[model samples]
Target: MELFVFVCAAIMVLVGALGVVLRSNPVHAALSMILTLFGVAVLFVAREANFLAAVQVIVYAGAIVVLFLFVIMLLGVDRAEDLRTEPLGNVQRPLALVLGIGMFALLTTAVVRSRDSLRFKGDGVKTATLEDADGNIRQIARSIFGDYVVAFELTSVLLIVAVVGTVVLARRRKSERTAS
Candidate 1:
């Protein structure tokens, strides 16, 4: 069951990546990236990283993607002209292709090596230390407040800034229209 879910999530992520790369419209690309982030979150949940999964969905899928979409909408990018400009042409094309191929080969080698070396005992997965609900909750609380407090605070501040900036931009646009 877990394997099946993982496979589906992987497929979704791959399709989303392709869509992000191939789509002509910036909005579509941003949406695709959101889908990719959602798949990653699902994968994290399947792996029993519940807190991480929630953070992935909340931070990346919800906040970051919405910000990206808002920026795309605010810019009012011309779809036709944006599509016409081949940004990856000329000098960057061959370099990008070579780098991509090299990265793929390196990743493939690493995966193969890891699979061959890594061994699983019993049911093939280690039992998590915080198995009980209360234990898990405590573990999560400690990790967040103890180790990641600064990061958590920073994320909240960042979100606040994003919200304020969006409102300011919208108000400025409305004031400009009224003046005109």
Candidate 2:
């Protein structure tokens, strides 16, 4: 049953990824990304990372995808276009292909050569005990608030700044249109 769920989620992820890459429509691509995010959430659940699964669904699939669609609709990029035309000229396609293949080769070489370095070298991860109902949550909270508090706070501030900036830009544009 576990294997079946994993396989199904993996397939969903792969198909969604392909849809994201291959779809010409921005809305369709964003929807595909949602599918990918949901599949990732399922995989996180399979790994017993319930918090991460919830974050994946709520933060990525919900908030981030909504932001993407909002931006797409705001910028009016939902129209069909000629996919064959190269906006960056003929050189970019070949250059991109070469760079992609080189990157793949480098990644493959690193993974093959660094097999031993991937093992966990630190002490065992601290997990919640069976008796403590909120052990996992407590440990996660401590790790996030105690160890990575600054990073977490900074991320929140940055997101807030981004939202404010977007709103300001949109208001400015609207005022300009009214003035015009």
Candidate 3:
């Protein structure tokens, strides 16, 4: 049963990724990202990291993706033609392809070489201190609030700025139309 769930989640992740890459429209790509985030949450649930799964769903799938769609809609970038311009020059596509292929080869080599030597020994040092399910949640909370508080605060401030900037732009457009 677990295996089945994992396989389904994995397949959905792959499909969502492909949708994001292949879709011409920005809104469709954002929707695909939501699907991908959900799939990742499902995988986290399968691993017994329920808090992580909830965070993934709430933070990435719910909040971040909504912001992406909001920006896309606000900017009216849903049209395919608006996205057709490639500013990286004519050689960007071929260069990206070569780099992507090279990265794939390196990753494949690492995985192949590590298969014989690398192994999961335990819950890991970070989580080994966690005695119960609640401990996992506490550990995660500590990591976020205690160790990464500056980054966390910065992210929140950045998100707030983005939302405010969008509203300002929207108001400017409305005012321009009224004055005209």
Candidate 4:
């Protein structure tokens, strides 16, 4: 049944999310991210958003996660971090955890308030679907290019800058080791 499938996908998403946070190894975390993305794609498919689901799998699980793995390998900083060390003194991790939980609670409350719209996918309920003749993805592209073009381009530029910075840092570290 659809309920069963949705439950399974939700469980996989939670497990993958926990793995991403709980795993010490960066590679394992990246792999878990792939799992989380794939699970999200499944949820999209269950919602009848086929194009969105495809893009989620192809772009996020495929390209972005591979980029993450590439950066991890290139930086050669994939070693396990010492979790016991509070490098930021005593106030960082606890504060972060508190903020994270508060944000999660807020988002969960928002989603629960909008639960009616979400019931369409699970119960075969008739609700307003976004797609028509032009398609849901076309609407997405229009918004991305028409309304948020500047932000979109800026995001791409930011990603390129991050990649360049990572490469430069890796090279600098290598040269430092060689000189030493």
Top lDDT prediction, candidate number? 2
Q: In model 1, which regions exceed 4 Å deviation?
A: 78-84, 116-131, 134-137, 147-180
Please, what is the TM-score per model?
Answer: 0.69, 0.80, 0.68, 0.66
Best by TM-score: 2
Model 3 C-alpha lDDT per residue in residues 51-108, reported as the tens digit of each score: 8889889989778899899889988888864435747678887798899889999999
Model 1, span 32-130: residue lDDT tens: 898898889899878877777888999898788888887778888726345447776787877988999999999999998899677665433322464
| Clash list (residue pairs), candidate 2 | none
Q: Give per-model CA RMSD.
A: 5.1, 2.9, 4.7, 5.8
Clashes of each: 0, 0, 0, 0
Question: What value of lDDT does candidate 3 attain over all alpha carbons?
Answer: 0.82
**Alpha carbon lDDT at 39, candidate 1:** 88
List runs of model 2 lying over 4 Å from the truth.
Answer: 1-3, 86-88, 123-133, 173-175, 178-180
For candidate 2, lDDT tens digit of each residue in 1-180?
A: 999999999998989988897788889999999889989999987886777788889999878999999989999999755567638688987898899889989999999999988887764444445777565677788889998999989999998999899797766666788999
lDDT of 2 at 44: 84
Candidate 4, residues 1-180: lDDT per residue as tens digits? 899879989988999999898888899998888888888999987886777888889899778999899889999979877657637678887898999999999999999988886654532323236545445666667778998999999999999999899797766666788999
Model 4 whole-model lDDT (C-alpha atoms): 0.82
Which model is ahead, 2 or 4, in terms of TM-score?
2
